[model samples]
Target: MGSPAANQCYYPNGRSASTDFPCDPGVDDSPCCGGGLGSTCLTNKLCSGPDGNIVRGSCTSQAWSSSACPLYCLSANTGGTDLISCSNVTRSDTSYCCDHNAFCCDSGVGRFDVVPSKPQTWATWSAAASQFVVVNPLSTAAASSSPSSTLASKTSNAPFLTTTPPGNDTTSGTPQPSQPAQGLTAGAQAGIGVGAAVGALLIAAVVFLLWKMKKNKKLLEGKQRTENTWPAVYPEPPKMELVGATPLRQELDGSYVPTELPAVTDRAELYGHRV
Candidate 1:
């Protein structure tokens, strides 16, 4: 029989008798009690022989308190018998056990069993999940449910989940219209119209400039001709002058004019004289 105080069986030599001894509710099994030679005490049913004094259960040594050890063990086995045994209990009940490897009822969407295959940045995971939910109605519904269910669904479906492209709205997949071709056509037509108008204006300006130049050249030629045609010589008007003085001789000749004495010399001289 075991000691009533320690709840552990011992041999007649006052040493531990069994290697599979159960732990006391509040007593630590490490640093096993001393006894005679060849006698041994085991810790948490995991150690054996005289040297098996260290606590070696599923939990670490620091968690060996009566309050913590059993809870740790129960939680480690939560997906199996432990959780099934505590299934009827509420989450707030101390008897309820939770699994660290599987999605627990209280764990959130990205925690516990939902952890990613490859390590993910917070932004990457959130962006991917958000896009998936936007495109998939079922995923969206699942995500809106309890955190544990959401996490479980996400983990199970991660390989098949698809995400919307960045900058695209997942709710609507409508594409935007392209504008380049239409814009280019309009711009080309406008440029051609403007170029034609400018060419016409330039031609008109050149014609006007040429007309003004020709008119000025003709006027200059007319002025040069008028200057070159001017006369070099001009005739003067006649003037009056006095004759010989025969006034005294003319009074005698008038009285003698009745006689024809001078007719002889005057005929030939007056008719043939060329002097």
Candidate 2:
């Protein structure tokens, strides 16, 4: 009842391979049927269970309505390899069977038949089926060697290479050390010295001019004070007399004195009267 599809065998991890094993009718035709009229069958691909039990199994798209076909264990089917006759399961009107594939599950539990309609049974069966999905050797080798090959390719064409010390950053674009600062030139140093000497000379000239002006001002003030004072005066000394000089009091009395003819003048007057 199901639509035809490829019986590509796959592991639980989505890995698959094409096998070189022979496909015999009935014994190795389909997972459920023993080579029907239009059945799709899968060849045996080895697997290992989680508990280390080895299982030989194949997948099929025969007489099943599910999109993904079921896988059956070749070693666990007690009544020949045809699962339909061995499990005695009947198909419902929906084109699904209660016993589709006898899956190799957990180690102690061995093979289990899955029911599509029952959620609980499907969950248990899927969990057990995942453990036995084999990983291919070729794929494992490629995965292991990928990093080394990439590293080799990067180093092969490099212009140069540098080894990073332990505890240092191994990334590209490391920073370099800076150069030392340059010193001043001889010409610049000489210019600074000359400028300092010129400044000192200018300062000394200004100080000398100020000192001369102050000294001249003090001399002029002293001359002005001397001109403003009055001349000193003293009393005349006693007059000095020349040798043989007359006394001032005597000279002044001589002009006003009467003559002393005294006796002669009285006698003459008496005689004239007698004549």
Candidate 3:
């Protein structure tokens, strides 16, 4: 290579800075600005000049923008800084920002967790499985106060000690909302959720397809049944024809002939076939 100084001198944005004393002087330094926005801050733990000079620059904080990563880091999963990696996220101060328990995901930390608190009960149960009664802490006192009355109060001013509200277990320290779910960090959990949704969609699609197929089959069957049960149609009949003839009086000197046979007006009658 010609020189490391030549590459680091020119920034991608057309800005140039030349310094005899490189940030690491004798060491070969890589080019900056290629990483894009917030890229300059990512080079080392502490901030420095464009050419990696230690004394020539001052530290200034810049908020990471959209161009910094593929996805925006959500508020819940974010640390002091907006950026997070799969392994760990380091802050500007060099302190470790995120805990290693869950994967730092694009949206945030994915949680598929199990509740930690154990439930407490004062009720007694029989092995017979038929019955159980909540042990009333005031049952004995009630019997003594008014022997005749079975449902007597413990005393005039004492409140009955029964069930406590959900989450108000006086026995332990305020139940710490179970520290962000134990295992299968953000990445694994997100994958599982996406997979489940896709599976459900596929199942629904299959069911709809099957229903459509059955409907079409029923329609075809109904059409065939109608054709089989229909009656046959008949064609039109032939029309009747008429015939006419002159009378026999014109043939015998215009006189009415009694001996001659009358004019045969009908063909069927001449043949003696008239019905």
lDDT at residue 95 of model 1 (Cα atoms): 20
Please list the C-alpha lDDT of all candidates, in the order they appear. 0.30, 0.30, 0.30
Mind sharing the TM-score for model 2?
0.22
- Whole-model lDDT, model 3: 0.30
- Each prediction's TM-score against the native? 0.22, 0.22, 0.25
Q: Candidate 3: TM-score?
A: 0.25
Model 3 regions lying over 4 Å from their true place? 1-181, 232-275
lDDT of 2 by residue, 1-275 (tens): 22223434322223342331112111222222122222222211222223332233333422222222233322222322222221212222111111223321111122232222111101011223221111222223223333322122121111111111122221123222112112233454567899999999999999999999999999999888886685556668899879776756534554676778657554444345553
Worst 10 residues of 2 by lDDT: 116-125
- The number of the candidate with the highest TM-score is 3
Q: List candidate 2 stretches off by more than 4 Å.
A: 1-183, 230-275
Q: lDDT tens digits, residues 147-179, model 1?
A: 432233322221111121122221222222111
Cα lDDT tens digits for candidate 3, 1-275:
22543234322122343321122212233212222111122212112323442111111111211111111112222221122223232211211112232433322333211111111122232334322222322233343333322323322211121111122222232122222223454566778999999999999999999999999999999999998888667667798766556544435466665696787766654446657
